[model samples]
Target: MILIGRTPYATCQTAANVKALRTKLFTTDGYEPRVRPIDDQSLPIAITVDLYLLAINDLSEVSETLKTTAFLGLEWEDAFLRWTPASYNKTEYAFWPQVEMVGGSKGIIMDYYEANSGWDIIDSSWSVDTETGDSTINFSIRLRRKPLYFMLSVIFPIIALAILNLCAFLLPNECGERAGYAITVFLAFAVFLTIVSSSLPQNSESVSLVAIFLIIQTTCSTLITILVLALLRLGSFDEKDEKVAVPRVLTFLMRKLKWKSRSKCSKVETEKDGKMHDSQSSLPDASESKVSRIEMPTQLHENRLFKEASTVDEFSWKEVVVFLDVVLFVIFAIILTTSLLGCLVGAQRNAVN
Candidate 1:
């Protein structure tokens, strides 16, 4: 018998059973049976019956190949005179030379083992009950999946979307579009994840590698969105504030990051007055020296010194945001590379197996 068609994989056994034909020897009471030539030079004999068989699949290693087994046998109505093997010496009946050959039909899944070799005739046996005189002949066949279709349809698309998600980091934070870009890519990943989940078998005992990869990518996309928002916040600050005190930790971080800051040049009135007094004294001008020596109030000098100190102690918010962007991009690149490599290795391993 030949397998003509196959259905998609399901959590349960839903594929149609293989078709087979069963033959038995029977005798007419007083006359020889008549035969007529139907095709070629072979004569057609009557009494052959068609049988449909259900194949039980083992999905324990469904991530790889799916193996299935089917049994076919003959049963007789009369329990008293049961059918026996043609030769008791032989263990089981053998198929005719013509029936042993198998063929495949078009539109069947490419990786189907049955399509290439037909069902492998793994084992056959004859069973007889001594007490009841019941007898039967049984044969079993095994089938394996190719997995090419699933790889192309589901796995590849998901990986592509994951790579595309990394592009969100390339967008500039000042444009206020980084978050939007990341969110859009994240949504695309989600849609593809849904498509993959819908196609996978629902009753699987463990999650498939492809599913795990998608979950990780979704998490990464979410993180990218959050990072973009954080960068946006860092880029925004009150520009009018002349002195923005920076934390010590942030200062240390900036030093470590090698960020450059604009030099604060504050000209104090006290320093200018002192310089003027020194220059006038050298010129030998008594009135000019006295005028320059009129010291400003101590309170004003102290306030000017405090304001200069505050301005010098502040850091630039824009510089901090720029540094954050570089750091986040590095982290994002690392994640993207790791994910891509992991998926490629998995695909290679599956193909090899």
Candidate 2:
């Protein structure tokens, strides 16, 4: 009703429309929510669903799971709720639902785990839009992971540790620290593997290339430890002992892969009173003193070789140990490098597939 002294503004139109929709839809004569909106009994309900991904919350390589946040928009027709615009005196008509669809996304959502981070949603909202007697919900949601983090923290560090394991062979065996050094490196690798396995899901059916790579590396480290001890023992043997001798195959390998330091001293001798004075040292014999001759091996070693009282003209056990150390280092380094690269490449291929 309009007051006699005041002008009336029309506000009853929207209120009337809402009241009509509620009564028509909610009354006993109206349709139920569970009932299909279609007129035909055999026909299927056509509902339009759209998901707009807003963010990615987390990623777990171990579990092979990804967590994300998005807008789950749903649109459908409610034939019973339709009304004529002229009857409501409005261009468009919409009714907002009073109570929310509480806990709708509980089982559907993947929760990210962090010690201090909460799994609770900050906020969420929805709005209704209609044009062709259809109800559309415009939903909105809010979302944070780096793919390279694993490569840097896990893969790169493993490569570095493998390289360090190979370097243990470079330490001199006589120093008495090589054994301890190799053992420590192996222990560190074992610890790293343990930590990595703990984070991964135990029920995983597929084996990771990275995991295989680490196992191979661990085996190599163990073998290296044994070899180091053997080499140390070989190095400590008495030079004069004829009982312990270098193997013939090792001698052959040394000649084949010899990084030679050629001897510069030439053979010289002096004759005194028709008696030949053999040169004991590399220098020419000034005094006519007779000395025992020394037989030299094919391989010559430099001052970097082991220091001994006797003139070590021939290839000694120490030289063999040094040669083997270099050979093993080269072999393992190549193996580790190749395997690491292959592991990463294979893993990437699997991911793509």
Candidate 2 residues 120-191, lDDT tens each? 344455544444233344555432123466778788888889989998888986878899999988998899
Best by lDDT: 2
**Poorest stretch of ten by lDDT in candidate 2:** 264-273
Task: Please list the Cα RMSD from the true structure of every candidate, rounded to 1 decimal place.
Answer: 13.9, 14.3
* Candidate 1 worst ten-residue window by lDDT: 13-22
List, residue by residue over 1-353, the lDDT tens digit for candidate 1.
22322222222221121111112333322222253323233633344354544564555564776655654444423222223433232223322221211222332333544434323233333322223221222222434345577668776787787767777666676786778888898898888888888876665576767788889889988898888887777666635655355667777888887776653323345456656855555575666766544543554577578767745564667766666777777887788778778877976886555
C-alpha TM-scores of all predictions: 0.50, 0.48
The positional error of residue 23 in candidate 2, measured at the CA in angstroms, is 24
Q: 341, model 1: CA deviation in Å?
A: 1.5
The whole-model C-alpha lDDT of candidate 2 against the native structure comes to 0.65
TM-score of 2: 0.48
- Evaluated with TM-score, which candidate comes out highest? 1
lDDT of 1 at 263: 33
